[model samples]
Target: MEEKFDLLPLLEYIPPSSLDYLEWVSVGMALKHEGYDFHDWDVWSQADSRYNAHEMESKWASLGHNGGQPVTGAFITMKAKENGWLSRQYEGDGMETFGWDDEISYERDYRFVDKAWVEGKEIQEPGDNWNPVEQLQTYIQTLFSNDDHIGYVVDSWQREDGKYSVRGSGVYTKTAEEILNDLEKYKDQKDLGWAVGDSKKEAGAWIRFNPLDGKGVKNENVTDFKFALVESDNMSLEKQNAIMRELELPIAALVYSGGKSVHAIVKVEAANYAEYQKRVEYLYKICNKNGLQVDSQNKNPSRLSRMPGVIRGEHKQFLIDTNIGKSSWEEWHEWIEDLNDDLPEFESLAGMFEEDPQLAPVLIDNVLRRGHKMLIAGPSKAGKSFALMEMSISIAEGLPWFGFNCERGKVLYINMELDRPSAYKRFKDIYQGMGIKPANIQNIHVWNMRGHSIPMDKLTPKLIRRAQKEKFDAVIIDPIYKVLTGSENDAEQMAKFTNNFDKVAAELGTSVIYCHHHSKGAQGGKSSMDRSSGSGVFARDPDAILDLIELEVTDSLRDMQGKRATANFYAEKIRDENPSYLNEIGQDDFLSAAEMRKHLAAALGDDRAWQISGFELGEVQKRVKLQTAWRLEGTLREFPKFEPVNLWFNYPLHVHDEVGVLKDLDYVGTDKPYNQRKAAVKSRDSAEKKAERKKKTTDELISAFSILDEGDGVVRIGKLESYFEKSRNTIKNWLKNQDVLMIDEEGFVSMRLELD
Candidate 1:
């Protein structure tokens, strides 16, 4: 048999005025629920908080159940340990009959009250009662039927007749039966009570339940049902129940709060914060339609309710149920997920476009449009967060970003990596740099979730609820990798994560910007989609994806920090609409000059004999591949002051004598002169075809010179000029050039050209 102590029937036998009796009752209920034999424990019979082990043994020896029965502390502890509830034992003061171990404490230890265990125990029917104690006990049992969390406050109201009406207004804990038994014993203690409604706080008008803090088996975990109490000034319980029944709400229990009002304890089985808000809103609207009074202020999740099982004024509050069984949270979640069906009636696409004149249906502005998702990707420690911070402020402040008009509205930036202090410092730095006061930047809320990586499933509902509470134009989640628990490379998992954000955007009508990391290596060669690490879902799913690449350090461009300043901001995928923002801003040209200079400084190291041939310049330019030639030319103009030298083939080489500067390049037959080459400007000829033509021309010239040199060892420059059908000066210059022939001071030339 399960050793059970029926504390309910014993309530009538115990005096209501004794505090010691009440405490003993509480201890006994807790002990009995854990299947412990408390009757033989004589220490519990005394009112003192502490009892000696010696006295416990003596009392156990004298007690009826202890006659030849094992009732000593040692036996009880051994039995407790055998049950696997006790972790270890310690020898403390001999007076300590039962207490928690100072070195370590376990939840199931005798000292710690497992309220959930107590609440789940089978109800023990009370004995025949003829006193007020039994009356109050029975009434208390009837009041808190569902075992919801409650609080209490002793309050007095001034009546119309001028007499003060006093009562205990309170709520109950998870173990309402156990707590209620103890509460009745303290009826004489003025204003003594339990937590009213769903919380342990005072409730003036109506009780409110905190959705995040429901009374569940795990006290710390959120419960499925959020209780909402309806209170009225001049409403009867019958009338309130009638209206509640008419609304067909999921009523867990109804309680009589006090004289003129009733508390309809409606329950909403919400899976998350967003569903909780929706359910409560729906409840409020339904109650109002039925002409029942409900305090709108009580709609907040943290609002308090009246404590069940407490005597108020002249009457005992009793719970009434509509006989509907408890709703399953799994089913309720499905119902809420189907809430999309209740969305406003649809309108034609053309009609929606016509309704909004200046605004497009989807695109709000250049930065981010309504109903669209954006990705801001960069390498780690590449100032991605800082760039996003500026963007967030711009959107919040209605300021232009990169010359793109920002659709001003409230923004939320969720930082999952940096600590609050570090994030704040960065924000301050950006604000000061922009010459904008922190206070001037409005509607931008920052949530620094350091050390906590909340997954998308858990994070989405919170963001949705927050957006619902206060309409947000955009929500930026920095370093999305931190909060994303799934594998980035897994297409299915990544798609699900991104789809969640898309849902948030669609539901809240707010744009979401996901700050992400790019894969290692320079981003210049790869397309924006390929640059981002992860499955293609991350790149393909978003409406717009932006890549910030640190351009390779080159000769002509250096960044503001005297480093390579060129950062390529690519609008990798801009779907459909072409916002002027992408076209108006040219970051490559804007920062290329500085970047080129920085690159040159690094490449020109050990400048001895450093020469820049047109071919070499063309090779560097090909790598840089900036759209415009002006950046290259501008960087070239900044080179160390040097005179142009005409070398082999009359090639112009900029000769710099300074160390660490490019020196004169050796003239080669294949190298074209600087003035003769169109290295910077784009050419009409294909590179392959141009190479072929140049080879043919060189062969023809060499053959012609070879034929002319057959008559003599040296050829006259004038004869060659006439034979080649070229000008005399041109021929003379060609003779003096390095590639053609060796010329003597006598004006004679050896035309036997050695062609490379």
Candidate 2:
């Protein structure tokens, strides 16, 4: 039985006030359908101001399983997902998952200082040399400009809990310059009471990290959204200081709080209040993820930091350092992200030589290796998906793929383009066309993600988690465009996008294979590596790049193939129903439809021949015309270059060209100069057509003579004209062009005997 998930927690991520009427009702419907109590819906709906008690009770009673698809918990999941809720798979103890839309760092473990290894650094009060005025001066100078208004709280009162808290909204009209001038004028005062207001010794003073508007002290009253406060009292003061420094947080001012925590005035440098909130949330999230356990309440732009140079009870709240880490917000962010790159460490070449590591085993022999990546690039309608499906079946059954031997192993085919039913039918059709029994059918797994495909970066972790247990040897994504994350033309963006493949390959230890379309225009003039669309990184990053370019099939070749196919079709029937007839037919006789028809007539007689003739040979020709020929060229990193493999995309299956007919066919564009090649080809085609016409005319004349000749071996020109389906003069001219016959003035034609 499938387990039912409790979706009540997902409601927390979604705000009830954000939804429309229908959406709000759907939530209740989903809750009811999932067998949750009406109170659960009522409690959740109460968050929205528009909620009415009467409407809620009425709507809750009305929601039930309708005739159509029921609104299940999945609707709630989707709503929650849209509101930035990631599934529980990403959550951990004390570690909240990043929002669905959050930029995930490449590595999850961003810890810089391990708590077990961190030692507490003792906090020291200013001694006899302490200058309280200078401490206050330095704090203001580091965080504020002369024109910026600063908000600070010096007045305090004790709460019922016996903890001291700030008394009113605090002062917000003082500028750094005015405060500095006041301090300089009162240098002899010895205490900050003369500069600002006197505070109780048991409660330290506080000042806003960000400069505020002179009007008020709320978040909107903040002028420059410059800095945020990172305070954690849960951990040892020493460890908090160590982590702040190790994290390289851009600190404008590092102040020691009198009682418990250190207030690190981290530089967020947000452009506005909205941006400030996001940056602060990210900063706090990162801190918590790395074991800092930051106090989450300080996310507002106008939040306070410990006021330096103040005395609280017996401890001093004073400046510890200024500008001690990365200089700016961008710099700090880049540094932290760089620390989480997750790239392998450098190893000594000598040590590696002595150890002699084994190379990854071949997955598709000479084409790809296990735990590597391969890209199959081709033009649209090139059957790239079908080729990938063939590869999947090949790997699953240990069969050959595109003439390359594949190791038998489990495969996961990610179908992002095709619908589930169509994708399934395609696989079945290919299997039947290839005439392979699915002995290891269980080895192939299909993940149909048609409408549900996410960006490759986001999908990689989820894919890795699911496939890790399967121990798949290869994972093939049908077409990458569905999950392509960034601008395909930008090299840097594409590089980041393609790196997800590497992540999947490394994490699951499987070969990652995917298909991409070729760039527009003639691909033949370019090398295989240059054919894939977008940035050159897509072509170069993979371990193997196999490009498919269509080969030009000539009209004569199609006709010959059509005849051969028709011949074989009848030959099979003859062999199956009347085996003795095939013995009388020569091997070469099967190459012509006419010869095959004669044999069929001899074997099946008039009745069967009439029935067989009803089958149109032109239909076979039409099918042959629809078939496309392709040449597979490869650029390999782990093996030597192999010759281009030629094959035909005959509908559901791709068959190798064993007869080498496609070998000499030039790709759509040759390397020759365009204009010159076009002229040359035109001239050659004209001359070839003239010769072909002459040969065809001569064959008809000779055949006419053979049928219309009298006992004396003489043929009348008029009779020959009628038989040849041309005018008498036209027949005479045709005879004149050929040396095989003669036509006299009386219009009597005679065959010429060879004189040896």
Best by TM-score: 2
| lDDT score for residue 42 of model 2 | 95
State the lDDT of candidate 2 residue by residue for 273-373, as single tens digits: 78888888778766765667665567778787789988988899999889988999999888877887676799999899899689999989889999999
lDDT of 1 by residue, 461-499 (tens): 666655565677788899888888689999999988888
Report the alpha-carbon TM-score of model 1 versus the true structure.
0.33
Runs of candidate 1 exceeding 4 Å displacement:
1-364, 436-439, 466-468, 520-523, 559-756
Least accurate stretch of 10 residues (summed lDDT) in model 1? 629-638
What is the C-alpha local distance difference test score of each model?
0.50, 0.84
Indicate which candidate wins on lDDT. 2
